[model samples]
Target: MPLWLLLMLWRGSVAQVLSYKLKLQKSMTVQEGLCVHVPCEFSYPWLSFISAYVSWFQKGADVNQDPPVATNKPNQKLHERTQGRFFIRGDPQTGNCSLDITEVHMGDSGTYFFHLGTYSYLDTMFSLNVTALTHTPHIIIPGTLESGHPRNLTCSVPWACERSTPPIFSWTSAALTSLGPRTHLSSVLTLTPRPQDHGTNLTCQVYFPAAGVMVERTVQLNVTYAPQNTAIRIFQGSRTALGTLQNTSSVFILEGQALQLLCVTDSNPPAELSWFRGSPTWKATPICRSPILDVSQAGAVEEGDLICQAQNLLGSQHISLHLSVVYPLQLLSPSCSWEGEGLRCNCSSRAQRAPTLRWRLGEELLEGNHSNASWTVTSSLVGPWANSSLSLSGPLGSGLRLSCEAQNAQGKQSAAVLLLPDKPEPRTSGVIEAVAGAGTMALLSLCLCLIFRVKTGRKKTVQPVQSMDMSPAGSSGSGAYQHQSWTDIPAAPPAPAEARPISEEEQELHYALLRFPKPKYQEQEDIHTEYSEIKTHK
Candidate 1:
């Protein structure tokens, strides 16, 4: 018992106190069905270090009254709570008294003590705690998570004991949540799920007080939703508009062309699509069953509507497309013929669609350009083709040119013809005109000769009447009343007179008289004369 020996003993005790970790992790969190390693190391005299002399103990919430539940020593049997779960495998020569636990179960969360038995037994100053994860966090979700609908998910972790500390819960989603602590701890997350949430995992983690790792669990949501915005589209045809068959735009199909329509939609599960023939109503006629609506022979008969319908277990939607056949104007026999003085033009064109046809004479396209011609006229369809006619009349010596143009949505084709009439040539026409003139002059000259001969005969008869009876109807007197119808004699008183002879210059030829137009005294003569005398003496 020297001073040096006393100092060495004091230093050894100090080393033991400085090197031993009296407290295991204040609390440890381990998962169920998993193994945990609790290591204990302390400074001890090299030769006296004994693994067989070590012992471990556990204390629950009521440490002062509750009996210990677990231990690793061999002198006493294992506690029922941790009987088959606890083991210590440190070598006998080593000072290590590390404990190995298998399939850690709940009810293991409590304070633990480590003791080393020597000449005098000593237990660690501070008690270590071993916590076994009561329950791994799990997620509970609803049957269906639809877009725009409110939803909630609960993450729960059971506590080992009523007095067990609350396990920290965390949610992967940044949603509003509420934490509840009871026999079990729960974190409820509230959110609205969208279609994008399909196949996404909602995760929850449970962390114990002293556990280095958190227990994580996930639930993959299988979101059930209706079909997205349904639209109609036409993948074929260069004439398609807005990727749809628009009522404003007539979808034209050529002869023998196929019309295909698609019902475009987006959904969780693929949507079932159908086709209808007309404007789809409550009582619409369904044509086929597919996203691709096929019109095998489009425009074979008449135009119709193609309604595309998309549906699922959720709902159905539709769109309509107008189908029509289109063709350019086809001109039939277009010709110009003579109709009396005017040249009549007739033309008929074949087309399935309506076409605007106009008539043009040379450069005149609007209507009539001259006073002699009439406006261009259009006629309704007589049969498969539209008939049009135009009458062009004018004083002309040459043929006129006319055209008929048929215009439609597809294109335009015009038919033209020259309007000519059968006529004599200009050179031959002059000869025929001269011959007609000569014949007319000869007939007039013959009539003039006949009139002259009749006048000569009439003058001879009038001369005899003038020489025989040149008497007045009422005469007072005359030098000699010879051959007078009525005459009177005048008395001469002792007077001798000589009369002069008439000169030839004073003579005049008698003019012919008309019997029908009588003189001015004809009205007076009618009273004195008989009806037979007033009549012509033909």
Candidate 2:
């Protein structure tokens, strides 16, 4: 043999010996109580020879002390430590050394080593990591579940891996005794819930083989729906009232006076309807049997409420109505008394409808016999601002009371005033007399001033010829006329001394210098009288 060929053969042997290797396919993590598969593969021709001899070992107290796990020939030293917790299934012929661990516990997590014994020698070791699966499924619940309504719930994994097996699902509730079908990942559990199943505790449990029985996931369920079982209640003012079966008795009146009752109740369904009254207990009663009840006029019923119920399959509801009875209008005693100088009174009536107003003196209607007396009637409707008034008047000294009566379909209201003679006040009459006397005096003064103006004009015409002579006779005549004219003017008594007759221009300047005096009634009256007289003369 050549030396180089021998070296080549030796190198090939070394390479084959050094090349055999095993490791986990990829990193993996698993929850406790779940199943995990630790992937493993090897490279070695001896794998086929000692396929059954392949053993798994975990790192021990020392670097050299690798403890053996399930294998064809287990060492007592290794078997005592890791028995029953791990199992291996693989084909050494194909160089596959993978492991499948079931019911994995927290203690099963650690580094693993695969070793093969062949030809009386242990080969180089292959390393792997065995991690316990440690996650559980999560459950979520939505707020409400109505009967015949679709519901959605979810279960999911907190952490997932491509190699990790998808979780399986099972549902349990007080209403359901057994688990249902398994659900898929990212899938919704949809169901139409019913009322009967409301308030039941629903649970979703997740299964992972590696994380054993004690670590399942679960969640609770809640549901809501409409109401049921409605009823009615009644009250009057503050006190509750009971239905009665009495007929025309004092409780019943010809005019109409009645009591009202109110009804109320609670339910999920809203209540509808107004106040209603009848003998619900007595089947034979007309009102009880009839769909509608006729209100009685003779026996006036008072205001009351009728309550009606609204209901669903789940619960009942209630509402109310107010009822008022109409009464006939009537006057009682027909007597009159004064109110603010007006007469008021009530008249008696037995008629079913309010009586129309007709004044009667000793049983005869006043319209025919009383030609002097006046009468008025006023009526109003139940609501505000609905009113009508009628009035009649007669001789002032007739010694009769004037009456005002208000009537409605239900009742009457009236007022009156006495027709007594009223004497006029002396002071008020005296003021009128003084005004007349002053007016007469003013007329006389106005007539005198008109006569004086005519006399002054005549004197001026006669004196103009005499003034051409510049004679004493002319001057004396002018002075006398001026004095008489000033006396007739009756203004400020000529200002104590005679004032020179001012020209029109001078008068204007004087007016400009003087403040205008405020007008007085007496001055205005005199002016008005003078103007009237001048108009009469024209």
Candidate 3:
């Protein structure tokens, strides 16, 4: 071991120590009252005997000023010499010289330097940029949000520069998300606005680096929408659906074909309303304006459903109504036809709505069993119609007037039929019944006499059709069979016709007033007609 060899090694070691490099971060970013880390690393000769200490110095705004801020010396706690805000996070023994700055303030914005010291010290400086955003976060909602439409809201945080670190943002609603980087640090909130969401509160929370303090801001959402209910009324017709319901439902009318319909609505922000046909295309070209709509315009078909729409900037609502244009019950003339022992009367007509039909004999409602009354609702290619019928037996009295009334919600109509040839005269006493019967019998006897007189010359011998009781005065008239259910008499049937020998002289017999011939027994049918038409004296 020569002294010269040791001196050479010593000089080499000194040169290696002098060549060691201290790496320092060029700049750091900080927010008011927040914490920041200064990056530092260094390389020195290994196994060296010099112990090293780490220190930090904050430079002034001026070019030539520097002041010590914090240090890590052996056996020294950070709180003994400096405030709790500043500390050393790295160990010089491990060549880590990183510094920590907590509770940073605006005045802490300056150039900073780091030093590694043993017997002497080696120092280098870096830039510190501090931004103060001590206020609350701001929320922005542009314009008005329309219900049922997609829209966006913004949570914005102001920064000192475009290059400044962006603040972390959180929203009370999970719908918040991030969009890359912009001039302002922001989080976007996307939503589809709804009418029920009006006046809802939305909050945006932001965590800033300056002081590590979180700020919250809230903004209310404004949503616009149209009417939710509508109703209609018709003049000269019943109110639709009974009251002011959203559905106009149905309206019935009679008489005139023309109609007036009024529409009423409830809405927010005052809706723009109009009348239309059944489809959405009708809205583009409305049939009319305002609340009133005229359905009967000349040849227009107003029988189908119509729509009323109320609209605003937000949305539109519609109400549906059926316009049933109906006319009064139209009863056609009823005709009576004889069917066996009974008579049938058939009445029919057209009506707008459902109709009820009834038959009345003067004041009493009349109905027959099988030959009875009937009513029906029938549908055609055009629309619906009703038909009805009534029947009566031969026992029905003569001069009975039958009336058929057809009625509906619109109105009523009627038709009548007369069962007799002429208007009947009333009878007062029971004796009048016998007198009237006698008069009828005498009139019929006169007709028979005229018929026999005409035939007397045709036949010389009496081809005795049958012999009648040459009885006199007034007793009774009987034949092989009596006609039953005749209208002239209430109970007695017409006498069966007979033919007998008649001398021409008997036709000339004249009396004050001829009495009714008495009914007499007959052995068999007459040789002449079985049935004969009766002729009455007017």
Candidate 4:
């Protein structure tokens, strides 16, 4: 072993080691069901070997017995796990050994080395880290979503390799959707949103068959819409809500009652609610700028329309209510009067609306123009007032009752009177009593005259005193007497009495005239006088 021989052997070994050099990426990361590219370059000492090939083999394996994971050599065998998914790019003659892998699985995660034909091998190796798929589907929305309008949406996985198996695509949403075009990388869907579909979720899910894994993406829908289903709810005072009116309606409210009206609508964006006094148009000013309209007095509300309008940026809607205020019934006093032999009675009543009138005979109720043997009834209507009259045609019964009744939708009223058959008429009874008393007084005056004549005859000779007769011109009857001033009358001397017995006719005609002094009491302002004359036959 001389120094010169040792030097020659060391130089040849150094040159061979420098020629078999490899430039490759040290490590690469790939997701399951995706592809990865490993760039590599190398230099070999065999420059005369044309039409050469390259292969890749898993590290820590026997290169002489085990097949390569990927190869470009003709008639060369490959590993079953990476036969179709792994390939070596570029020719070995150009010293380019780039490796490409599609649909990489967890089992493919290992270190691999480059092999140059059967005699050359690169010591430099690269590691592949195959992790679970974390790539989610991408959802692309081209434009804004409007309610009731159709639009297209796309979901795609652009990172996936073209050589990989096509993934299964599915969609989940609450909106109306239909299938559109589809490809190995992307799927298209036609979506029609509604007002109710606003703020809802839409999901695009994809299934990788090669790796048996699923990936998904979710997006919230923002749908714009106009007002719809506009309505008004009515509430009386503090009570619960009553009817709901979607369009025009008529409502009858009692006078002076409180009311509440609420307007409501459905839309994507919230709508503005307002209340109007009458039928509203687009330019009408609103009375209230809120959803609720409170009326303190129903009677004060005019007989017209009340409108509730709901408006938004997209469109508007409204509802109307016609208000009618009603009042209670009122009745006037009834009257009854005598019309010849029949009794007539009248009754009248008035109200906000026209009222009806009727009659009650004792316990029976009668209406319209009723005619019977005993009584008759007639009715008439004039504006708000209703009138009725009753006539009794036959003789009245003892303690009989008659009534006039008036009624309307609000209330009813009646007036009654009692009649007695035995009672006399007021004017005739007074006249009869006065005449009887006057007759009695005349008889008493005659008797007093006879007494006076007997006394005078016994005391003195029967002498006749000639007295001036002041009787009126009609003086043939004994009852006739002369009229003198009440203040200056003198006492009369007794006339001579006749000896013969008085005849019955003369006695009937006989009368006495008496004068009484004025009463001393200042309280008495009037005096009553009766005159009768005494007549004698000799």
lDDT of 4 by residue, 378-495 (tens): 8988755788888887777676767667777788876655453444221111233245336745764455335223332234444332243444343445344443322111243454
Q: Which pairs of residues have clashing backbones in candidate 4?
A: 471-482, 511-533, 512-532
Q: Best TM-score goes to which candidate?
A: 4
Task: Kindly list the per-residue Cα lDDT of model 2 for residues 310-415, writing each as its tens digit.
Answer: 4344544433344433344433333433444444433333333334454433233432122334455544433222333333433234444344343446666543
lDDT for each candidate structure: 0.55, 0.43, 0.59, 0.76
Give per-residue CA lDDT, model 1, range 396-484, as digits (tens): 44555566788777788876553224331111112333454366456533322221112322322211011123233443343323342
Comparing 3 with 4 on TM-score, the higher-scoring candidate is 4
C-alpha positional error of residue 226 in candidate 1 after TM-score superposition, expressed in Å? 2.6
Query: What TM-score would each prediction reach against the true structure?
Result: 0.49, 0.37, 0.41, 0.66
Q: Which stretches of candidate 3 lie over 4 Å from their true place?
A: 1-23, 31-35, 41-50, 60-68, 74-86, 102-107, 115-123, 132-212, 215-328, 366-385, 395-399, 418-538
lDDT of 2: 0.43
RMSD of 4: 15.7
Ranking by TM-score: 4, 1, 3, 2
lDDT tens digits, residues 338-444, model 3? Answer: 56666666666677774666677677764322232332222222354566666555466666666767777767877666444432322212333346547766765
